[model samples]
Target chain A: MKTFPILLKTELKLSLRGMDMLIFALCMPVVMVLILGAVFGDRPAYDGASHTFLAQSFGAVSAIAICAGGVMGLPLVLSDYRGKKILKRFWVTPTSPAMLIAVQLTIYALYAFASLALVSLTATLLFGMRLAGSPIAFLGAYLLVMVSMFSIGALVGGLARDGKMAGALASILYFPMLVFSGATLPYEVMPPLMQRIADALPLTQGIKLLKAASLGLPAEGVALPIAVMAILALVCGGVALRFFRWE
Target chain B: MEYIVEAQGLRKTYGAVQALRGVSLRVQRGEVVGVLGANGAGKSTLIECILGVRKPDAGEIRLLGMHPERERKRLFAQVGVQFQQSAVQERIRVGELCQMTAALYPQTTPAAPLLAQFGLAGKLRQQVSDLSGGERQKLFIVLALLPMPQLVFLDELTTGLDARARRDVWQCLKQQKAQGLTIVLTSHFMDEVEALCDRVLILRHGQTHFEGTVQQAVAATPHQRLEDAYLWLTDDEREDNA
Candidate 1:
């Protein structure tokens, strides 16, 4: 539709002006890569793996941007729009609310990919960190992680009555996922009981899949991760659609 | 008679409180109809139902000879609305907001001329959050008119405006009326109603209590002034209900 591009362009412009989230989502992962790669250069992973620490952790670190944007930034913006009646204004126009939601999702997806590229390129060029996994498999797993994480955001934004509630819910999910899901804290260093707790989190499975693909190892026991991410994407995405409020 | 809007026995309830109780009215084509009401009189609720923003619990409503619920896309394409509490994103620029809105409709008035007409030519690149309230109101008017709609709804369009800014907005509405645009407005200012409305509808306790010209409204009450007449009508309704 003609209106999609117009909405996308305007939305992107507005997003660029408020660069706080953009910086966090796009730059934070690359920053993490630089810091971690420097501090632990060429050191073996604590899991007794042959690859350097950076190579094993790069896939998980790349997912930090998606978690930030999808869980926190997306819901906050959407709920703020609804609270201010921006969506209500659009509801009376020829453009449906679904179109606006689609545009927002596309924008976040672009951020996710851009963050991935920046982190990958920086790690490869600076630290000789290479992804040993199949590129196609890595990409597929990355997309599944994005969809699953973003669906949680859609549910929060769609159901939250105001911005305050959305922010509260997003923070509750965002911080724990960032720390426990091997994004901020390396999974290999955690104790056995901590690993079990981390594994219970939805994002941990995604990290495992990414780690396997990035290490070029056999994607053994991938069925469970795939099923969990798929079910989460379906359930959250379905509920969000069902209860989506335009205003 | 061709009615651009028609509603019969419309009712809405929010929990135990009734917002609209069997309210109904009709607007003929090309008429500037002013809706006046007290704070809790269901003026916004009625407008929302008619615009298909909310569904009425019990009523049949039509806009531009089409059912609002069944033909919402078509109805929205032909109607423009400015709400009392709705806005674009705060960071969007004036020109960008106008362009985005224009892209939604099949036809549009040029954004540049419309912005200039609303005295926003210099504010084209200004962020919406930076504009004063009156300027934001004017920008909303520009957006509402960009669609070149057949019917426009403005709810409390001049609530917070100063006298001069209010008049400027009124001047823009007068020009639109001159171009044969039908407008449905809600306001507390009797002078505004007298200056622009061809007919007036007043609501009390969620029902239509008076429907006529300003002159008829004045003539019906012991007081001849439009403001006094409005007060008398509302007080009369309160007394009757008591």
Candidate 2:
């Protein structure tokens, strides 16, 4: 427990002091939200509500940060540490590999929360959008999505050989989730076949589950998506931990 | 006196390459021993086996009278180590690194005194990346000595240092040895071994060909020099490779 906080502090300091990862974690998400919000402004989503696009899309934007940092950002960082022998150096110390992993998860969760807050603030103030569903539900959905995305990232980062490989793997997962998962393009607008493929993606289910929460809709239909997200979270998270390779 | 480090009939292989082949050696308490070897002579493998970093394929290893592989963590605390190229995060300050590493141990001396003693008192706040090679080496030595360990392993600790820095490190080692710490080190510098090692072991092809005082090792060679003796020990090794 103590090791987690210590390592988290060190990681956070490193993240802040370094420019590249900081831009990837903080700058890119804010830029994406602003650009997407501006370009998509005044355009109505599939629903006729003028402001529906902002509210729902804002949730997607938050999810983007979670996916980008947790899925892509974190694994590269962890793999880089391993490849550079930083993790190997720690192996000689009293610190266990498990503690190092815990620290990474903690820092990523913090980034997720920070991104969520920023996106929510931008949508509410700049776009004059209101969340349709219960705030508690929104919070719950956001946390679940963050955890699911982070687990996937951890699995990839742990299994990859180096930073380049981790970055490639993360990109393979991220772009599809961003584009085809109904985060950027609404699910109903996509072809039926594409919709089926999106349905198979964890991000698509995550977005649907989040949209249900933000729209105040009954979650009875969301059981399937939620179940899928939960299962992906478990299986990927377990495999990541079990087969995690540290240099 | 009981041997602080003992290995018997040790053997290790990585795929087709045999790193250690029935190699055996022993170091008694408070002895400053040096392992002189050419590239691929298995000095590092022998040290790693003793440190529990690598397990021997055959035979046994004992450090401080306990099995190293099974009791790694407990033995690690009792031993101090400086590897070939130790590196911490570039942005991490020396003081912070010292503090962090010190916290990992159950008992530790304060970093302030160690820094001052190593002539790094002014560079406590300086990031590790900014430090010169000698300063980094001194920092590592300070970290290794923080626990007042009974046995210290230094692998080519003076590799990149200038003559003055090398002498400083040797002096520090001598002082530390006077305080009753057993030192085991590997060095390519013949003068370093002659100046410091109470006994020198020449390793070639993962076996000890010569083990005695510096004078005896030098006297055994036709050329009567540490370098010549090292070459002589590995002459058969070169022929076998050819």
Candidate 3:
């Protein structure tokens, strides 16, 4: 465990040098929040909703960073390490592969929460957007969504034979979730068929849980979404663990 | 005999390909042992099994008097290895990689003096990707030696090096051997094995074809160079099998 801090420091330094994850996971979501807040500041979110558009979309928009980091950034880095034999190098040392994976997850989780905090601060200061739900419940939903998204990345990274394959798989999962999961485009504006399609996506269910927690709405009918996110997290994470190739 | 490594009846198969077949060898303390083999001759498989990186299909192996599979962590703390294809993160600086690796072992040689000894003092702040291939290989050797380990394993340690860089690495290995470090190395360069190894083991078709001192191996094919002797030994086995 003593090696954890050294490894984390090295990981953070390496992450800073790369900066691609920083731009995509940390900077992009803040930019989105600012743009969405400025352009549609006071528009009503839906026919019967009392919140403005930015307020309604806040939960989903916050998840954009998670998706970027978890689906795109995480897999690319892990697969690159495997391709370069970095994990195999560590396997011979006192530090094991399990420790490396744990450290990576911890680093991405830090990025996700940092992105969340930045988005929340920017939204509140720029547009007076505030969460209406229990802070504890909102945090719980945020963690669940983050874990579910990262699990998908782990599955791709753990199974991919190389970086190219991981990148291809990550993109296939990333773009669609960003556009159709009600994270970028509001779910209320989608056609009936699109809504049904979006409902089938893990991120869509994650956004629903997030929106309820953020709006302080009773999670009366959200049991299914919660269960879906939980199941996705478990199954994907389990598969990733079972099939992870250290070399 | 104070054997640093001992293996018996080591058999390993990857699907239908037999990577190792009943290979056994031993190395005493302070001995420099060179493992020589042609491509796919099970030198790597033998090393991996002994290092506890891979399990043999049927064998018993011990490192430093303890079973490697059962005492991997304990064994790794005392043994350092430089794999043929292993790499550090490209963006990491030289000093940082050294420091991180040093943190893994209970005892370590300080990074600064060691880097200077290897002619890498000025490259401490340089990223790994920025270094030349020889410099990177030297850095890997430095890492493998940093733990002050009782034994070290180096695979193709100077494969792509210029003569000067190769000599530099050879000098460092000689210094370590002089300090009573038991070294196990694999190299395609026959002269490297002759210059550095006290004893040489040649593997052919996943079996031990020859195991003896460099002089004994050379004398076996009298009036021939070590490289020719090596080829003659392996080629003789190939002919016998045919």
Candidate 4:
């Protein structure tokens, strides 16, 4: 229990002291929110929905930070540790792999929560958008999506041996989620066939749950998305634990 | 006296290369054993097997009368290890590294005293990246002794150190040995083996060609220097390559 906090502090220090991953994780999503939100501010979607483009886009855009941190950032960090034999050093010590993984999850979760606060506050104060759903429900949905996406990151990062391989796997997971899961491309605008495929994506279910929660929609139809998210969380989490190579 | 480490008929193979083949040896308590081998010899593999990082295909290994592979956590808590080229995390400060290492041991000595003993008290705040090669190696040695472990594994611990720094580490090892700690060290430098190890194991082609004191190993060859004797031992294999 005590080791987790020490490891988390070390990881956070590592992230902040280093420029590359921190810049990408903290600044990239915020930059995207500002740029995309500015260009499409208050414009109606093609379907003439009641919500402004800025509001809808920003709500969906918040999901991008989760995706980037988990799918892109997490895997690379895991793989680099493996390649550099960092985990090997820990293997000879009392530190368990579970402890290491728990630390990583905690650090990323902290970042995810920070990102949410930043994005939501910015959208509300600067863009005149209102949060539509129960705050508790929205918070619950965000945590679930973060867990599901981090599982994917851990699986890719733990299994891959090098940064290049991890990066490639991350791209395969990130691009589809960014484009098809309604973060960058609204699901309503996609072709019907593409929509069906998007429905199968982990992030698609995640975004669906998020949107449904934020819009105050009933939880009845949201059951499928929740189930998918749970499955993704379980399966990826299990595989990552099983196949992780320390060195 | 009871042996601190004992292994028999250890065998391991990686793809086409045979790392250890029927290799066996024993080290008594408080003995400082040096593993001397050519680059391709199974020294590292043997150390890995002893550390329980690599499972042997055919062998019985006992460290302090317990099987290391089956009881890894228990064995690890009592053993200290300094690996090859372990100074890659250069951005971390020496003091922080020491503190982090101390957390893993149930009973750990304070870092300040250890640093002071190593003449590194002034460099505790220096980043690992800024340290000289010898200082970095010394830092690893300090970490290895953080727990005051019963059995310590120093794999090439003095590889890149200068003569003075290498002598400093050897003195520390001698002090530790005098206090009844068992030491198992591996090094390619023949002089290091001569200076520190009480007994040396010469590994060739994944087998122990010689197992005796450094003087005995030296006496076995007609040549004077241990380096010459070592060359003589591996000369046949080099000819086979030619």
Candidate 5:
């Protein structure tokens, strides 16, 4: 644990040099909020909806970084390290591989939070957006979704056996969630059939939970999303732990 | 005799193939040991088992008077390793890699001087991937020694180096050996073995075929040079195994 801070600082530098997550995870969500505000400025989402289009999207758009970083960035790094035998090299040192992994997780979480703050600030300052939900509840919901997405990433990274397969799996999980999970596209606007399909994606459940929290909707409706996210976290995190390999 | 490494009756099988069978060797403190073998001769498997990266089916092994698996964290602190295929995280700056490595050991020598000794003096901010193969190879050796370890394991230490770079590395290693550092290295380069190793253990088909000093190996075979001696010794085993 004493080595963690240095590891984190170094890993953070590596991530910044790698740059994919910076563009997608740190900067993309803010860009998305600006796009949302510009495209549908101050206009109500639908005829009788209380929220404007940007306001309606505030919660889901905030999760773009999580879906990007947690689902794509985390596993890609894991598989790359595993494939290159970097993980094995690190293992040859006094540091445990778990320490390296924990540092990576912390880096992604830091990026996610930074993205969230930027997205929220953009929406509020540029387009007069405000969170209607309780601040504490909103934070809780955000973290739950982040965990769910990150666990799925871990499972793919642990089980894929190599970098190529992990990259393929990450793309398979990333694109559909980014496109159809109400993160990049609005959930309320999708056709019912499309909605049903999106609901099967974990991020869809996540966005649903986030949307409810952002809108200050009734808590009664969120039980299913909560259960889905929790179960996904437990199962995926457990399986990842069970099968994770250093070499 | 203060053996730094001791392995007895090591055996390992992979499915239908036996990679190591009853292989044993020992190294004393301050001695440089070389392991030489052809492509599929189980040198890697033996080394992996010795390093606790892979477990042997049957063996008792000790390094620095500690079990590799039982006291890994503590053992690793005093031992450095440079694997044949270990390319670290891409795009990581050399200085950062050194910093990250230096942080893991309880005691470490400064990396700048080590890097300088390997011709990478001012390349700290340079990314590792940007280095040439030989440069990367030298960087790894530099990293291995940064821990100021009592012993270091190097596989294919001079594979990518040019003649000058190889000589420079050999000279640097000679200096390390002079400073009471013990080394265990595997190399196909017999000249490297003859230059750096106080003793050589030749493995064939997962078993020790010869164990002796470089001069003894040449004396056993009717060859003038260590390389020719090595080739002549393993040639018969190749035919038998075939």
Candidate 6:
């Protein structure tokens, strides 16, 4: 539709102006890649593991952007617009306010893909990190993980009554996963109890799925994580669609 | 003459409080009609119902000759609106918001000239959050006119503007009415009603208490000024006589 491109461009400009996502979604992943490369360059992931620490963590660190954009960037933007009645303004126009949501999703996707590229480039160039799996497989898995993570945000954004509620919900989802899901701090370094706590997180499942695909390891051990991501995507995405409000 | 808007027997209730009690009015093409009301008198509820932003509990309404509820998506293309609580994206520049609003319509007036008309010519790069209240009000008015709409609905159109800015906006809207744009607006300023509205509808207790020319409304009361007449009509002491 004619409205789509204009809305997308406007949203992109607004996001760039805000610079919140740029720092968290775009810059953070690259920073994590750098930190991983510096701290554990050339070290194997664990005894008898097929990939080095940087290579293994590459998959996990790449998900940093996904977590940030999906949990924080997407919901914050949605709830802010709704709370301010910007969504109501668009609703009175010929265009549907769903276009706003679509544009936002597109922007986050752009951020996620750009973040992925930056993370991959930094890891590959700096620490000689390489993806061991099929490039196509990694791409598919990356998108799946991203979408699944975003589904959580969609539900929170759709159902939240206001910005404050959405912020509280997004933070609850974002922090534990960022710290213990192996997206930032190494999953191997967390205490067993903490790992168990992280395992309950949906993003933890996303990181596990990405980890298997990027390492080119057998995905056989990852069936649960894959199912978890797919189910979360379907369920949360369905609930969001059912309940999403324009204002 | 063809009516650009028509509504009858509209009723809406929020819990036990009746917001609209069978209110109705119609606007002919090229006429500027003002809805005058005290607080909680259902002026906004009526507008929102007609525009399909809120559904009436019971009513028949048409906007732009189309059923507002069923054909809202198609009907809204021809109507421009400015709400009192309007807040655009805080981080967006003035020009960007205008461009975005323009993009939503099939036909549009150039944003620069509209911005210039509102004394916002040099504010293209300024963020919306940084604008003064009057500037923001003017900006929204500019946006409401951006689509070159055949009909415009503005609620509390001059609420925050100073006398000069209000007069400037009145002059601009008068030109638009001269160009055959129909307008339905609500205002507390009788001077604004006198300047722009050809007729006025006064609301009391969620019902259409009076509908006629400004002169007719004024003649109904002993007061010479429109504001005094408004106060007289809406005064609680006069309720028993009416």
> Each model's TM-score, in the order given?
0.97, 0.88, 0.97, 0.90, 0.97, 0.97
Candidate 3 deviant stretches above 4 angstroms: B236-242
TM-score of chain B of 1: 0.95
Worst 10 residues of 2 chain B by lDDT: B99-108
Sliding window of 10 residues with minimal summed lDDT for model 1 chain B:
B85-94
TM-score per model (chain B): 0.95, 0.93, 0.95, 0.93, 0.96, 0.95
Poorest 10 consecutive residues by lDDT, candidate 5 chain B: B233-242
Q: lDDT by residue for model 4 over A137-232, one digit each (tens)?
A: 988998899989999999999988687999999999988888888877878778999999988888888888888787677789799988988988
lDDT (Cα) of model 5: 0.90
Q: Assess each prediction's global lDDT (C-alpha) against the native.
A: 0.89, 0.79, 0.88, 0.80, 0.90, 0.88
* DockQ scores for all predicted structures: 0.79, 0.42, 0.73, 0.46, 0.75, 0.82
Q: State the displacement of the C-alpha of residue A136, model 4, in Å, after optimal TM-score superposition.
A: 3.0
Clashes of each: 1, 1, 0, 0, 0, 0
Answer with 4 or 6, whichever has the higher DockQ. 6
Candidate 3 chain B weakest ten by summed lDDT: B233-242
What level of docking quality does candidate 1 show? medium
In Å, residue B34's CA in model 2 sits off its true spot by 2.0
Instruction: For model 1, state the Cα shift of residue A134 in Å.
Output: 0.5
Superior by DockQ: candidate 1 or candidate 2: 1
A1-247: candidate 1 lDDT, tens digit per residue: 6899998999888887889567887878888898998899878776577899999998899889889888987898899889888788777887777788888898888889989999999999999987788899899999999999999999999999899999999999999999999998999889999999999988999888888888887756788888998999999999999989878
In candidate 4, stretches whose alpha carbon ends up further than 4 angstroms from where it belongs are A35-50, A184-201, A218-224, B87-90, B161-165, B237-242
Tens digits of per-residue lDDT, candidate 6, B28-84, equal 999999999998999989999988889899999988789865776677778899987
What proportion of the real contacts between chains A and B does each prediction keep?
0.76, 0.19, 0.69, 0.24, 0.76, 0.83
Sliding window of 10 residues with minimal summed lDDT for model 4 chain A: A20-29
Best by DockQ: 6
